[model samples]
Target: MDDQPSLARRGPRHSTNLVGRSSEWLESCAFNDAPAPLHIWGVQEMNQGLFGMLDQAADLAEAGEAFHAYMMAMFGIDDEQRDVPSAGRQRFRSSFLRLIQGWSFDSNGPAGAVLKGWVESRFGVCPSFHKEIIDAVPGPAWEVYTEEKMSSQFHNNAIWVQLDLLFEFCQWAIRRFAFPGQSHLTLYRGINDVERHLIVERTDRREAVIRLNNLVSFSSDREVADCFGDRILTARVPLCKILFFPGLLPSHLLRGEREYLAVGGEFRVSVDYV
Candidate 1:
């Protein structure tokens, strides 16, 4: 068995029953001493499903039970039927406890260097970032995994999912930040970490409000109308870049009628899609 992380290029090996699960290896890596391993962000569906269980729940504690089923399917955390180590059997317990506790990655410090580099490559921009809130940046890392493993649609809905996740995560974080006004943002799927968001607002056309992005309700409707040629420029996310973040995003893309997650800026605005 490989005891260390491989650095050299290796071809895909045939499946084996004995290969150690990364979850176990990750735990063995001894990073557990850090903050709780955070829950998956951009899981609007999971949150929705959990909400559905609230009424069925016997009490407040049992409300989110159904949500665990998805987690099991996605992460295989509860697959005890396989003949594996006793430590593996205890996997579910540890993972379960970790879930309720909440986790985080130290992005600004040395530990998050890998993640920062990964994000930069994915988005072609170094994030104006902080260490503690790496999870808040929202990437589609397991979107494809979620769909294939669970047969759910998540790709098309990624923009909103990440946006909503970050918006909500920032609520409880109590961190001070300046978003620096971005117009275009690139998204990435984090294979081992949260995907990245490239906020592209500081462009040459910063003054020309040709598009009033729904992502940001920057100006009043009248002002936006006055700036653009068409009175109502519909704003939408950039689509070509969707395929940029590989993995689960492109594999299990979201489908019909469930396009957006409703990011309201409480300002009347227009949009321009590329």
Candidate 2:
């Protein structure tokens, strides 16, 4: 068997209290260690039925369909019909597809908050930034962050289950494509300002420990990333931390930048101001 240090050796229940606190992320989560050895991100005990279908799929397309079907079941939607109450009681559609779409349209909006909140809950990592900067110490910014998360999730009851399955699907894909013993993906993000981010430590003039938002967008292609801003931040992202990536779903659902949604924690990154 492969001897990679599987981070899923033990299952830790989602930490409710630790959500959205960047200052406590490195100390609270097990991800502060070396990134290369981690295979699963603390999810070994997830219900086998929740994502086992992915393991049996013939290809990525089949896996995507299987996940879509699973998502529909969570919302009580099927080809024939869906229960009104089970469908969620709100203006926004509670479907996982819509959530990702909403985030793509505006990462500073309600959908983005919900996605970040979910990562905080499941991974014990904190959202380093939301509509505004966030920290471990509660303040007005924390209040705003909490409010957005609550309001969005209130409309999409039980939607977290869909996200849970999504993460499982992503991990399965990572495992499939992580061939020849490679365990990390080099990702880049273009931003307008570097100071707006939470820099935990400066290892050198170009490298530092960055506390990324609980859910952040990154691109595999450097040119795609450069289109976003004048500054670029690049890092070697651990496979276990990626929640969603291009081609993981239908191209229509995930467009622009060949984006990947990365779950946050403290990570060493190189910054470039161009």
Candidate 3:
């Protein structure tokens, strides 16, 4: 067995009220007293099915339970029949409790770093960039759609699952990060091609928007800007912004989409593929 601290060891419990906090804040508070190996093997074991639970969660309490189940899955805890002995199971359960209680908005701390790295390793997009895109949106009327939920025709066979998991992580990261009075995320599945384009166009016209594609591996804002050539134009929408994945040829465009996809006055806009 590993010599690291067993899940039985007690640590500071996370608070239930996490509405205003960032992901970084949550991680710092939760793992403040915990030792190394915050990157456990079980976290990778989480699949898309388990992640979908977040969307279906009815309330914070239900969300908390779903989040706990996610962590338990990560910890390799068997939900069926309690594979471990009673004492061990209790320790695992206690540890999972601490884990979920610690969950909050902000992803800049040690735990956040672990999660970010995990996301990057698994999904191929930078978590920080993803967070920035989310933050750039206007009044939080945005919704997250997973590939599993999207139409089969729209799914990218190569990266559909990864995209779904990426959005899942994004949803998990931004749970309580929304501003007060902001609306909850609408879960979208079975969106058609036209609907996807309209969603992008609507978001761009109304508020700031950022759409991420698998074609690009984003590390910094500079890379995002460079993806577009000298054709950068001033955005009509005040704060609206869109990011296209790299490697897409300038000629490639989504059907019913404008030539330019980027939408911020301050930042250069790129029009490539959605």
TM-score of each: 0.21, 0.76, 0.22
TM-score, candidate 3, is 0.22
lDDT winner between 1 and 3, please give it.
3
Question: Across residues 1-274, which tens digit of lDDT does each residue of candidate 1 receive?
Answer: 0001111121112132111222222211122112122223444455665345433545322322333354445444444412222353242322321211111212122222323232222222222233222222333432321222222121222322332333332221211121223222222111111012221232232111121111111111333233323222233222211111111111111211112211111111133321
lDDT of 1 at 116: 27
C-alpha lDDT score of every prediction, in listed order:
0.24, 0.63, 0.27
How well is each residue in 1-274 modelled by candidate 2, as lDDT tens digits? 0001112112122444322333344332335444433233434356566467767887887777776676676576443222122235435446566677777778877878788777766656556566665543377766787788777444555767667767767877777743325567788888776665556678899888766665678888888788887877788777767778877864455546678887765567888976
Better of 2 and 3 by lDDT: 2
Top-lDDT candidate index: 2
> Cα lDDT for residue 108, model 2?
73
Task: Give candidate 1 regions above 4 Å deviation.
Answer: 1-51, 79-127, 130-274
What are the per-residue Cα lDDT tens digits for candidate 3 across 77-154? 445312222354343322311211111222222222333333333323322122222222222311221211232322
User: What's the true lDDT of residue 7 in model 3?
Assistant: 15
Backbone atom clashes (below 3 Å) for every candidate: 15, 0, 9
Question: Candidate 1, 199: how far from true, in Å?
Answer: 21
Query: In candidate 2, what residue range of length 10 has the lowest lDDT sum?
Result: 1-10
